[model samples]
Target: MAKETKAQRETVERVMREWKDGALETSRGAPVTSQQQAVAIALHEAGQSRDETPAKNRKNLRTTKAREAKASETREVLYAEATKRGIPGRSRMTKQELVRALQPR
Candidate 1:
């Protein structure tokens, strides 16, 4: 882990305090309801958390986005996409399987 600057540390503290006070919000105008989400938002606002470098933070952000995107899709939607794509064995495939089949390469 890299050393965090005073400003960065302060940023985290401020954001966390906001979260604790029920004043923290996500970029999309949603109220931050989870400690994990608050921490991620705090670290992002600070440009880095104590535990990760900037590069790692960006990577984690990308991974979180991808997972959220996947989770946003319903099983019925996945099935429709799989059917449209003519995926093999889609009839018996699970929702996860359909998602994997439909995932962009």
Candidate 2:
């Protein structure tokens, strides 16, 4: 299981949501339209950039998986969990969108 700190997960969710709404912008004030670019920007802003070496990335993943309460699971795992949890519109959600819908307030 991966453990995303609440703040980290929220950062990703907020950024992606803004991207979907055509509200996310780049450093140059251009609207962010690419999903991949949005994710990269989200992670980078969260200080978990994928630009790092593979080993470091793997280490980060492992650490997240081994974390305690409310641990974040793998995409497949989380997807299945979401299905069972009856998350609305889950059938249309990409793996990265899980955090936003979980136990939504």
Candidate 3:
């Protein structure tokens, strides 16, 4: 029930149809790849009207913000640790790769 732009609505509808057509997978239900899909499905299950704003959408937005903040903090810490350790290419490495590289052998 979030106020979606036309493009967003089309994207959600396409995803749902593809899911039904067996053209998509949840990729083992990984949160990153499936988050939007989950939201769409949840709205559908809750009988969310396109014109009515959903309370759960607001709650979910808060949750998403919290997750993003945590991830940003983690990236900052990882960058600092990598810099301290003098890890080559640390600046270019992604968060997950930095974490793997910094893990104890």
Candidate 4:
């Protein structure tokens, strides 16, 4: 097997450090899925420069934020509907619970 060059060794080390440090977390404050981590690792291995990484990460963050906002809005609507119908425990319910409780019996 051919020996790895210095640059390839450096790239591997960087990717490993990022993974160990949990630096690839998703925008929603969750750990990135293994699939995402693999993509990022592949990109880094391809010698993609660091200057481009932030922009791609930022775009992902914006999309995650939008999705979270939509989910929050849906939860709020469910809460409002439950309150209007005098459903008890609405305030205590999680978003999923609120959705279920607000559904037509």
> For this target, which candidate reaches the highest lDDT against the unseen true structure?
1
What is candidate 4's lDDT per residue for 33-80, written digit by digit as tens?
A: 585574565344534425456567445444434433445667778788
Pairs that collide, model 3: none
TM-score of 4: 0.31
Question: Candidate 2's C-alpha lDDT?
Answer: 0.67
Per-residue lDDT, model 2, residue 4, is 61
Q: How high a TM-score does candidate 1 get?
A: 0.47
The order of the candidates by TM-score, greatest first, is 1, 2, 3, 4
- Write the number of the candidate with greater TM-score, choosing between 2 and 3: 2
Q: Could you tell me which residue pairs clash in candidate 4?
A: none
Give one digit per residue, the lDDT tens place, for model 2 in 1-105.
346677667667877888999998896779998999999977765446657765665555444333322245666776787889988888788765765456334
Once superposed on the true structure, which residue ranges of model 1 sit more than 4 Å away at CA?
Answer: 49-105
Error of 4 at 41 (Å): 39
- Screening candidate 2 with a backbone cut-off below 3 angstroms (N, C-alpha, C), the clashing residue pairs are 1-65, 2-72, 3-64
- Relative to the true structure, candidate 2 reaches a TM of 0.46
Greater TM-score among 1 and 3 belongs to 1
lDDT of 1 by residue, 1-105 (tens): 667777567767878998999998785668999999999888876668557776886665455456447757998988887888888899898876776677666
Per-residue C-alpha lDDT of model 3 across residues 34-99, encoded as one tens digit per residue: 557655653443335353356665544444344334455577798998899999999999996777
Q: Can you give the TM-score per candidate against the true fold?
A: 0.47, 0.46, 0.32, 0.31
